[model samples]
Target: MYWPNCGKGYLGPGGLDNYGKYFNCTGGVAGYIDRAVFGNHMYKHPPCQKLYENKVYYDPEGILGTLTSILMVYLGVQAGRILNTYVNVRDKVIRWTTWGVVTGLLGGALCTFSRDNGPIPLNKQLWSLSFVLVTSGMAFVVQAFLFMIVDILRKWGGRPFFYPGMNPIILYVGHEIMRDTFPFAWKPTTETHATYLFMNLWGTFLWVAFSIFLYKRNLFLTI
Candidate 1:
């Protein structure tokens, strides 16, 4: 459920109001249940008015959004199951690769259709079903492409990505901690977009180099 009315300027019209309408229109029995439970709660506990007014990105769905996230993970699990199936290597590649392309195209078509004809448009904030499909489709395509390159061709690999992937949590936390600090951030003389871009690129390269150094030492972090 997406609320076009509420955001930087609007409040009171909480997620339930929007999603209830959505459920009424599209949810059927499930929608009725949701409206009965969540809709009632909306009167008691409206969304954080201040958060919506101040925050740049806010979704009233909140924790309930995890329901869709679980769905996304389930789709990934399905993909993994396909990969692990005992099939000929070439046949496996073809199946996964074809599946990726088909899903990607289908997701894209859904997005386009939703944007043109609906009460809801494809929105990342809302984590709309269409957004999930589009992202999942893209993820499948990317994974397939990498698999073909690294596993099938064996000509190239994800060496650059491997180090970062190995210590993703560390890398992410370190970046967040150092985001406002030196090297990662610097006062530019010109203060142009290109200046900021170059700074970011330099910072990224340094992290990559650091990851490679750690990789060479056979150091990895996992949690």
Candidate 2:
């Protein structure tokens, strides 16, 4: 793959693997953002709470995000156990999650498209969940494609690793671009909900497309 200087310039199959390894091992994506924005660049980026403020509801924007934050923490402990094979979770809920996601995406999109030029509400309790599931699914798709990339590269004996430095840097760079470029220019400043909504959707589709492309080429990241 031809390399570009900026993260945005990264393209083709191996790029995702190039980043996944670094971010996967470090504080995941969030920590990488901290280092990229704080350690390497000027002006620390806004807090996640600030950047992803849920406007429609008072949840995270008020005491809700805090509440969910606690639950997320709890889930982390449980997740560790599950990944280590300490316990196997039943697929009952997650099995139905895809349907929920499709509904949410369709509903959210419909509502979004119907609205005129204005700021959308955050509704973290409702919408943020959509963001999480959608992105998580997208990430998995990306990983799958990266896996294929690695498989083919091995035929020629070129080994590549998904580094531990890529996730946050990519997110930070993407967020910064959104904040600076205003890709969704029609979105008003007060419409934080709409901003996040569209950006995430864009990210989701972009990553999914990337994954599909890589998968077709048999280029995947080797974890």
lDDT of 1: 0.59
Tens-digit lDDT string for candidate 1 (1-223): 3333222211222333344332222222223335545654532232232222221223345443457677788879977987898367776667666766776666667656555333334555445556677678777777777878898889787888777887777778889998778877777676554777798998888788878887889888886
Off by over 4 Å in 1: 1-64, 113-120, 185-204
Which whole-number lDDT from 0 to 100 does residue 114 have in model 2?
Answer: 32
Work out the TM-score per prediction: 0.61, 0.30
Q: Report the C-alpha displacement of residue 59, candidate 1, in angstroms.
A: 4.4
Predictions in order: lDDT: 0.59, 0.37
Candidate maximizing lDDT: 1
Task: Report model 2's TM-score to 2 decimal places.
Answer: 0.30
Q: For model 2, give the 10-residue run with minimal summed lDDT.
A: 53-62
